[model samples]
Target: MQMGIVRRSVGALLAVIVLLGAVPVGAAEKSAPRHSAQAIGKAERAMQEITAQAARETATAEMQDTRISSVMLHWTPYPAAVRYAVRVLRGSVGAPMKTIATMEYVYTTGLHLPLMAYGAVDDLYWTVQPLGYDGTPLAAASEPCPVREAEADPAAPALTTEYAAMPYAPLYPVYSWVPLAGQKEHEVEVYRREVGHDRYVHTLRGGEYDVYDDTPFTVPGTYVYRVRGVTAAGMPISNWSAYGSFTVAERTPIAALGDSITHGGGAITVPPSYQLYDWESYCTVPVKNLGRSGDTTEAMLERFERDVLPFAPRVLIIMGGVNDYRVGIYGAETVRNLAALREKCRAHGITPIFLTATPIRPALMTARMTINTPPSDWWAHRDYVNNWVMQQEHSIDVATVLSDADGELEEGYTTDGLHPDLTGKKYIGQTVDSYLRTHFAYASAEAERRVRMLKNMEKTS
Candidate 1:
């Protein structure tokens, strides 16, 4: 019945909007092979963009009594849209990003996705894309919007921090704590260890604050941290919590930024790629996993700054294109995306480590008739992408490493036809870990990290 409601609403909306033209762009803008535009005045294209800009999309979470039950996204009615497709993306907007829900447009209102879809996640991010009849995308997607809980958490609040550079606060490493419930003040413990090999040991007592802006870190090495609630009497109120690792003097770390394969997609165990504990979890070197499932090269590039570059790692591990191949992206175009990524990494002095796309079973590709690359031509396309990957000095030959006799995914390495199983992830992790040890030396500096990142900004007036 609910599904039928969506269909009826979409059908009614489409009937009315059959004549409207020009919609905003989304991820499709970066890599859509060709766009079929209705003949609208040049002003219409520009007007649509301005209207979308003038109309800010809003997000609010639903409260089931005291608990959050869902997140609702609201946008101004686009008279031209026959229907809208809402995409609920996860923490980051890169490869392996999942599409949690797809909803039809209701013009003047908001739509929601169940809170459970987020799976213990808070503050989910998303964007809305306009669609025509037959599910053809009508316009570019809107800018991403984040949904945060307006209600309070009754439980002892969980905490996480993000590292940001402050020109004003030069002496201290800035750890901006995420807002928490039931506490105005918080305590933090900061510690340093070997880059990747050792465990994070609590080494220092720090102040309770909305941010960790005081206390000089003084040391020049990789560091990990934990935070907890503090009582008014200057006592501990909660257990120290763990988030992903942070850096102090990150020894020229390398980050793997790709889709599901790099993200440890399918079933994950022992450790996830997110905690920087997946296959890349060895040798005392940190490999930040910036992977999001279902990300194309173009989408990964769009999120380069927010997800990949902020850590200022000296190297980047890149593996993408399978998602693009599904959309029938041409080999030359896909290579173009990788080449652009390489150039960006170079400008930032971050060496690019290219990885070949893992091969998938022909049967799987065939069964998914919707995919642009069919079984007959998929192998050839993979070879083409792999050939390009091999041209790079730091390339890891994963396609060969994970290919079976029939040239699909290797028998024991995958959870399914396309994604890697635990064994397969280990194999990739081993290859990446070994390569990093042999290639890059133990050397990094603040200047080295900043030099390339600064050049990324275009000189705008």
Candidate 2:
């Protein structure tokens, strides 16, 4: 009996050893395969080679923000490859000059872990300096590099993550819409701002959703949220989606009052011209953008009774001070100018909604580089008037407030800091919409009338 038991135990041990030996040696040893060491090293080196090739191919694609230009590259997609077409202009395109370099990448789907193939390239890598046509060295071009490989399996167990996307508009609150279909077992986290703090406000399990929507968040400020999807295999994809920011603003009527930003500046249809008032169409109430380019706040104040009062607008939106601040008006004087305009609106039983001044931009910065500071202290003056405006909110019934303190200036927002470019004006319209949704009672017919008026004004404008 003893011999039989020992023999059975030995047989079991031998079976286990054979099973372990059958697995791939490299997989078990946690190391590279010996026979293919040379080949693997070559592949690793090829990554750097491709990066170097990319630099040479895209030499002319490099540029700077100083020239008031944009980088427009063509995206041509094939089965598994993409090519970039480049066009760079230092000055006039009077004659077709030889482009600096063109770049492209090739991808394959076959065997042996497909590689980043390349096309023809120019020697654009500046580390090995090359002289230009005139023997003058052109600016050295920066080089591209390869992304590193992960040490561990991305789908490994024990990792957990979350992601979220929220839309934020300064001075206006927003309600988000999130869909839950395939993400049944994942954990969802929502971060919201109250007063000025962002704390974890809501959490839902995988099987449950729809617990967050149209849910009011904090006042006006930047809020971030995240959600994490976890698979049964314990893999986590917690990448946070882009931040969706929407400001919280008091609702007010669409005030049609101003100049160039209103009248549409330039020739009948050029940027920085009168076309800026196209946003009146998006307003909740009728707005007659009686703005004229080169019009000052004082000038606007002078004509408020004649131009704005006749419309019987429930709310008067006013965005000026760019011209005032540009001409050296600061602090209290700015307040007085804005206050006088507000008073005129109040006298005519119209509510005044103030659009806070946007920040001074870098391009505009150079013109005043010698002034110690930009001519427009709109940043400071705006705060002063806003403080006063907040106080008067009770006295004159100013309902909505629109501001751009948080929105980053992209090409569309402002060509310069003071004026709203085409897209910037439209963004202002969105901001105004958010403000009206919050502070006013839209259910009222009076409110509906205001909406109709805004629609007509938008059509005419």
Top TM-score prediction, candidate number = 1
Provide the lowest-lDDT 10-residue window in model 1.
162-171
**Deviating ranges (above 4 Å) for candidate 1:** 1-252, 268-277, 282-284, 362-375, 443-461
TM-score of each: 0.42, 0.36
| Candidate 2 per-residue lDDT over residues 83-188, each given as its tens digit | 1222221222244334333321111110011111221222111111222212333234222211112111121111111111111121111122121223334554
lDDT of 1 by residue, 1-461 (tens): 33444454455445435534234456336534554333334345655554443332211112223355554455543322445787776665454556676565422123534565565545466678765424567677786666554222322333322232210112233332332333445666666565355554443344433342334333444455667777776576765666434433322256677876765423221112122224543323445556666689997887776666656777788999887765567677788889999888988888899989887764544453344444456666777888999999789887786787777787555423566655666677777767776777552233334423432321120
In order, how many clashes per candidate? 21, 41
Candidate 2 lDDT: 0.41
Q: After TM-score superposition, what is the CA distance of residue 273 in candidate 1 from its true location, in Å?
A: 6.8
